[model samples]
Target: MSTPYAPPAGYGDISFVELVPLALRFLGLGLKLVFLALSYPFSSTKFSLKRVLWRQFVRAICPPSSIRQLQFVCPATGVLYQKYMRSLPNKPPVISENIGDGISLHWMGPKTNKKVMYYLHGGGFVLPAVDGHFYMLDWWRNEAKKRHGIDFSIAVLEYSTYLIDCTSSCQLSKARMIGLINFAPWPTQLVQVAAGLAHLLKEGYDPANITVVGDSVGGHEVIFLLAHLIHGHPAADVLNLEKPLAGAAALSPWLCFGTETTSWKQHGHSDVMPLGALNKWSGWFIKSRTRTDDSYYFEPALAPAEWWGGLEKVAKNVLMAGGASEGMFDDIVTTEKAMEKGAGKQVKLEIFGQEGANHNEALVEFACGDAPGSTNYRMLEWLKEVYA
Candidate 1:
């Protein structure tokens, strides 16, 4: 049977260890709600409560201590983080590989370096990496071996907190670098990812062998990176991934911020993330004070149909999975339609479990077949077919 929402064995529920952070989340959430309510009289904006609450939880961990000055606080919090990291269950061995320039490569499973899966985790582009991400990475490695007898080595690029092509002088400007945590913007994040991918290609891994996957906002990065590759790059000097990627997968990606999405309104009813928080953080990360009516950061869904048609050379195969119940469900379906119609049938769309961290638990469903016709089972089948 599909595992319950409670974390797996030894990966216990948010325990007493999390009480302090939990308390802060509640406190911060209260203040945020109060401000949101007050501002609504003048602003009249709607957002997701759960997403706003989760943002508070992430902020407690990463903090506004700023990226450069993180040394001051890492000594105290890093130890606790390490301890917590150790408690997560069934993660594959992740080795830290320094790819330079604040872009680090986390290798999951063995060091074969072939059959690599490039991944990025999502926390609205503000939070630090979570062990759940590593758990999913490990699951990908193990599941591939179990189902298809293939040993897949996953390399995830964890981009830096600050970005390069910051458009606005708002929250993430160079001047804001003095003491604030500089959450990155635009092509900068894409460039850092490309840099890491370039390092892999340079080290002799075939571009056709690398499969890129991203979750939530990380999914947006994956799409953005692929789209930019097709369009010949927004800034060629910054990021022009000349070689084609084997495939790409976006797990319930965060798309369609500038435009209106039905899911943004129905988030509380389905998806785990609230649209309010998505709207808030996306604006900050994009550094756009005024919401544009179209094409938020060249989001593929908003772009012309030609963008999807160009994916023929950018990716060999593309897999998109989104929960039918997820807030982003409509957008995923929308993008999938575009890709299927415009990009050819090289793209496949699979509807999976309910939203939230439960997507990670689908690994169990794949292993046990507790959910008949589970999405990951099909996912594994696709991998075997393509990678064979």
Candidate 2:
């Protein structure tokens, strides 16, 4: 029997101490919304009224002031995803396995399914999986069959978020604990994702039949996972695979944690991601690091091109996509070029510049209760071709 699924400590519901800050955040959000509404006509043509509103809503809830502050308001992803899965009618069989070490893998189909897409969600590594994540995953599962006649399961890994540093006391002020809070630090996510892959391998699934996929930070994790497979991270255990996986895919993968590119300056305002949120989240992730020379995994764009030399040995193929209007466009292109230089013929990249496209466009659409758009169509088709 599998271990009973348990959510992270403080999985749902906010504490009394968080109420004041949460309330103040809401008040500030209201003010911002009012300002955006009044200034709508003067805003850039790059953003539609709907897109602008959505961006502000995300920005308001995910503030740059504190990581813990965002955690306090956002629902814990594991429990919420579980609830959403249960509520789905005629959905694929759901299997919940606590693969140990506080990491949970929620399989959308049975473990015996030969083909799998190991999905890692993106929320700056701080926010948990939202309803949109599940909705989009389920939609893709159905569409994969309907559109391409491919049968596959999706195993969504609910890795722990970086809430607070393990050594920091709860009594510390949010300001004092900004950079010091290290709960669920660098190697923690890497370890958990690798464990999820290991579990799939141990269950008799061929590495050649599995494709790892992620969005934004999840995409960042996918890239590093490939690097780790090639170079190996000392802090994490290794996976013993018989052969390269079928493929890997990332949508708007946050390649570099910094915002110093021309794309950032061009698309920051029009995109859904707030510049402040990126700054704060990247700072928290970097500051929580326990090592000094960890940029090979954390900052892949800045790493020497030789670091990804054996990526073709990790996966048979790689598919990376980004929206031309997204701030991470330049970084995505840079990372792609570096990987291509090393891995040669194994890398394929697509940049969609359709009107209104932004970072992780597929996910953003699902969040707004919109149907899957071009990016989703391309990803589903790519899965079919790779698995062919």
Candidate 3:
């Protein structure tokens, strides 16, 4: 059994070295502001208060700073933990010990419950899971309990969150300082995901009662996993007969690889993720693998219409939600079309486009206050549809 978690000696503060990039970022933003002001007189573009201010804010502060590129130091850092725990003590989750499949699964509701919603978090397969994700899951668990007498068990098959949320502080700080750097190769992680689910099935949990949710690259993982299950991978056979899942959802799922969709730049203005970074990350992940640039797992857009249809047998209902202003919006919109075409009407589907919202906008607790509803609101409706 794993030991209980311990807190860090102090707040996870950034060193002066880390702040050097902040200074550089400010200078860069200042120059951009000067340029925006100077260019406003001659430019033909009409500016709104929100757009102009946001454009400036993003230009100045949202790029990949030294923090991201340099500090692949450890996936084990709990830098975001203390703040999250303080903010949401009422929604604490049960972090499982090494479940033997080498995957860290965190459960957010009734410890003995069988109704499981397996969640995979997004961060371009590189960054950490933020606190908004946990809060949203907790809210869903509470709502599910209230509406139906069911205890929703959220099995977070995630990495970064488990690093902080599950481990001891001595491990967190030392892991950061050790500066070890390595990422699990492509299909290896996917295979482990299949194995993780198999473990649950092995434990006698019903696959028919399991639902799935994910965002961004995690959403990509969802699609890949479904495709594998629908095709009857031996791992999925643990549940028998390849029966469809109860339901599934993906938020602003990153589906395209190799080429940027027109929407990436079209909607990049309000998004924090830059096209170059997206390209670099995706490209970097696939470089050492055997998969081609157009492999279905890596690039679903190029796959046949039937590939998505396969998911109908994989998930009975699939909900996809994204910010209209997100760089991946068009791609997700296209994915919905492909799924509908391929699934051949067996699956119920919902597509939500949050107007003026940016990428992965639905997962965060903050909604930018510009849209009518939230990702969580739609998620609740979808959760009820599946569980009820």
Candidate 4:
């Protein structure tokens, strides 16, 4: 039998330098809770006080400067407990485009070919831009070139958030409504972008080399895109309409929307997100934007198996990476099971065993200075195998 990995001795001991900041985080969460309780009404509140408390508790133990930052750190640090990862070499340049309302894409890597990785960021579908993922993009580019000698580009989707309710128009007609509702449909957007990538491929690039990767809700986007393609959506007409995709990867994907997962209980009091808050806020955003319940996109779990027909047949090379410690363990497991039930085949699952690694750890691993053994490496390897 193999022995489980353990962190260095005294890793649990807090240093004086780290204590003050930790204290501040606790204070922050407490203050946020007070703010919610005193100001926000329970009926209108999206998150629970307990969830806020849990976020604070976790932050005090291992704090990230902001909620967006936490999405990267929690998963990475928790999964790769003892390993030290190197920081990303350089930041990617942000490019703005007027698709319809407006959308931004963080372009990275050598722009040799249109073999791109469209990254859908994770933040329960409500958070702002994920600048934290820039380092990960840098590391991915370096690894792809080093291993496969093929230059890969990245397009980080800058979707509008319900929080900001930015009134930007995208080239796609649904952009403004999707942004306002904060109900960005994974299936719809995937088809739209895939078509766009297909167009780029037809213009010159290789269709077999394009890949899609997302984290958290973004992870869900990856699956949704594959599902959309398998279902024969018309969005492929915009692009060259290739077979399926070269590959896809999702890290810590938020699979189930209506279920009460363990993380829901553990972080129920989290200041950042309360249990069941996403559904309410996201649903409202969607209803407000679309002027309809249209629960299909908001509550994907309710969709029938037929809706995802042929997905497993097409995306046999899909890769899913998740942390064991995060609150979403049950949700991930359920999603895997649901995929098995729907696809009737084993989906690749990579569960990281880093201590304290939570929802944000995978993103954190790419940015950490001295992390060893990353799932990102595994993802890069898989991409090479599938696209080679």
| Candidate achieving higher TM-score, 2 or 3 | 2
Task: Give candidate 4's TM-score.
Answer: 0.61
> TM per model?
0.68, 0.87, 0.74, 0.61
Give the clashing residue pairs of candidate 1, or none: 47-276, 48-274, 48-276, 66-181
Tens-digit per-residue lDDT, 37-69, candidate 2? 889998776555666667778877775445556
Clashing residue pairs in candidate 2 are 164-183, 165-181, 165-182, 165-183
The best-first sequence of candidates by TM-score reads 2, 3, 1, 4
Off by over 4 Å in 4: 1-101, 147-150, 160-203, 232-240, 266-297, 302-307, 312-316, 341-356, 366-373
Instruction: Please write out the lDDT profile of model 3 over residues 33-112, one tens digit for every residue.
Output: 77777777687654443345445653454345422333332233233333454466574543543454334555565546
* Per-candidate local distance difference test: 0.56, 0.75, 0.62, 0.52
Whose lDDT is higher: candidate 2's or candidate 3's?
A: 2
lDDT-sorted candidate list, best first: 2, 3, 1, 4
Clashes of 4: 43
Worst-scoring 10-residue span by lDDT in model 3: 160-169
